[model samples]
Target: MSIPNEALQKILQEIGQKKAFAEQQLAIVKQQMAVKTRENRMLQLTASEVDSLPGDTNVYEGVGKMFVCTPIPDVQKRIASESEEINADMSNLQKKQDYLEKTYENSKQSLEQVLRGGGS
Candidate 1:
């Protein structure tokens, strides 16, 4: 038995929707990754700059609208921790991007097959 024309159209439409949704999600994930990567880079640079300063030099960390005087070692530790968190976030986003890419490809393939009269 073969799928009726109406049902086939519906199937095709559904696949198309899935493909579009996946594309949107992939774009968002990429944007998020970019932001996180930039933040991580800045943190790395700040850590390096802070490390070069004399131990006696005062360091300030931004807290809300004010900069709170903090120790060099404390600033370094905070930067390191923030970098780690951003790295983890980027890794998770990468995994999600991979999955969305695969999903989009599969949807495209299925849509092509259906359009070519190869789908049941």
Candidate 2:
């Protein structure tokens, strides 16, 4: 059975939209991943620097524009916790990126099939 030209056009349009949407979502995910990765790296570096400091050294954590003197151990713990959270966020973003990539590919394939008259 042959599918009507109108139906084919509609299917193509829908698939194209899906492909575009997925592409946009993928870009967003990539940007988020980049941000998280940078944050994680900064945390790692900060942790390293803090570790090199003497145990009695005073550390200050920025709070809105002013720095408040904080204990070394508290600073270390805070850095560790922030690093873990950033890593987890990056992992989740990676998963989302993978899923979006697959979705975009599938949409592209479907669009191709429809264009080639194989979708009927």
Candidate 3:
């Protein structure tokens, strides 16, 4: 059966809209990943600084170090969790984008086939 031009155009438009939405989502995910990475780096730097302080120099150095390092583990864990989440989100987004691209290509090919009187 041959598809109408109006139907084909509508499908193409819908595909374009979906593709644009996916691109937007990917951009936001990228921005979120960047922010999370920066936060993780800052946490690591603070942890390293705390570890580098001299315990014998200050009477409260031990307490300071312990206090600082206490939440380091939690922060590290959170960073890892966030990183994993971001990776999963990006992977899923890429998969969706790939599928949409393939769909667009297939639709275009089908439209071409219809136009060429080779409907199947």
Candidate 4:
């Protein structure tokens, strides 16, 4: 027997909601990647500029919106460590994005089938 109209509608609605959620999550992941990329670039630029500067350089690091005098070596180390972390995070986000896209595609196909009077 065919599914009831109300039940089919409910299923379709739920599928639509899930698809929207997946899209939103995908957007968030893309934005995060952009932000991480920018941060990585900034770190590279800062390191290069620091290298060009004369020795015994004094720099101030922003800590909770306050600049504190810090040694150059420490700042460089921090930048190196954070870049590695961001790289790992980017890889993880890429995997998550791939999974979300696959799920969304499967859901979309099911929704289409249901709309065409086929079982979801």
Candidate 5:
């Protein structure tokens, strides 16, 4: 049987709206992923710099290095702790990204089905 024109139009409109919303959500998720990755990279760099510090060496070559070497022990410990926190945050964001991806896919499929007039 042929689908009613009004019903088909309504379905198409709804589907289009849903697909657009899902696309917007996916964009937000992408932004979040990028931010998380940048933050994680920064954390790793800080941790590496801290790890290279030699606690026993009081005198250093450069001014910046000398300052860092002053509180070598504390700085190393703080950076290690921050790195752990950033890692945890990264794991959580990864899980969120996976979930958002699945949601986007499912919404797209539903929209396709609706537009095709496969409604029950």
Candidate 6:
């Protein structure tokens, strides 16, 4: 059966709204992925730098809002642990980004189909 113009317009509008929302979500996911990637890189670099330092090297680590004096050995261990956590976070965010990309593509395709009057 042929669809009514009003119903088709309504379907197109809903698809347009969903498409816009999905685009925003995708943007947010990308921003979060970038932040996670940066954190992962910095953690790796910090761990590498700490590894190269002499065992007697003096270093301070941030505890919450303040940097506390910590022994080089302790700093090294903390860096190693933090690096692992950051890597895990990066992996999770990567997966999330992949999912979001797929969702964004589907939303775009749906919008295109609706615009072409291929309402479902």
Q: lDDT of all the models against the reference?
A: 0.92, 0.89, 0.59, 0.89, 0.70, 0.78
Cα TM-score of candidate 4: 0.85
lDDT of 6 by residue, 9-108 (tens): 8887887787677778778877887887787788788878878888877888878999888997777677778778877877887787777778778878
lDDT (tens digit, per residue) of candidate 5 on 1-120:
667879778877776777677678778767877886787788688667756767575533246545334466666666678777867877886777777677767778877776565554
lDDT of 4: 0.89
Higher-TM-score candidate among 1 and 3? Answer: 1
Candidate 1 regions with alpha-carbon error over 4 angstroms: 118-120
- Model 2 lDDT tens row, 7-101: 87788889999999999999999999888888888988999999999998888889998999999899988998998899889889989999999
Candidate 6: give the clashing pairs.
none
| TM-score list, all predictions | 0.94, 0.94, 0.50, 0.85, 0.66, 0.79
CA shift of 47, model 5, Å = 2.0
Top lDDT model: 1
Q: Which stretches of candidate 6 lie over 4 Å from their true place?
A: 64-66, 118-120
Judging by lDDT, tell me the better candidate of 2 and 6. 2
Clashes of each: 0, 0, 0, 0, 0, 0
If both were scored by TM-score, which would come out higher, candidate 2 or candidate 5? 2
Better of 5 and 6 by TM-score: 6
Q: Which residue pairs clash within candidate 2?
A: none
- Model 5 per-residue lDDT at 10: 80
lDDT-based ranking: 1, 2, 4, 6, 5, 3
Model 2 stretches astray by more than 4 angstroms: 118-120
lDDT of 6: 0.78
Q: Which scores greater on TM-score, model 1 or model 6?
A: 1
Per-residue alpha-carbon lDDT of candidate 1 for residues 1-120, written as tens digits (9 for 90 to 100): 678989998999999999999999999999999999899989989988998999999988888999999999888888989988998899899999999999999999999989888354
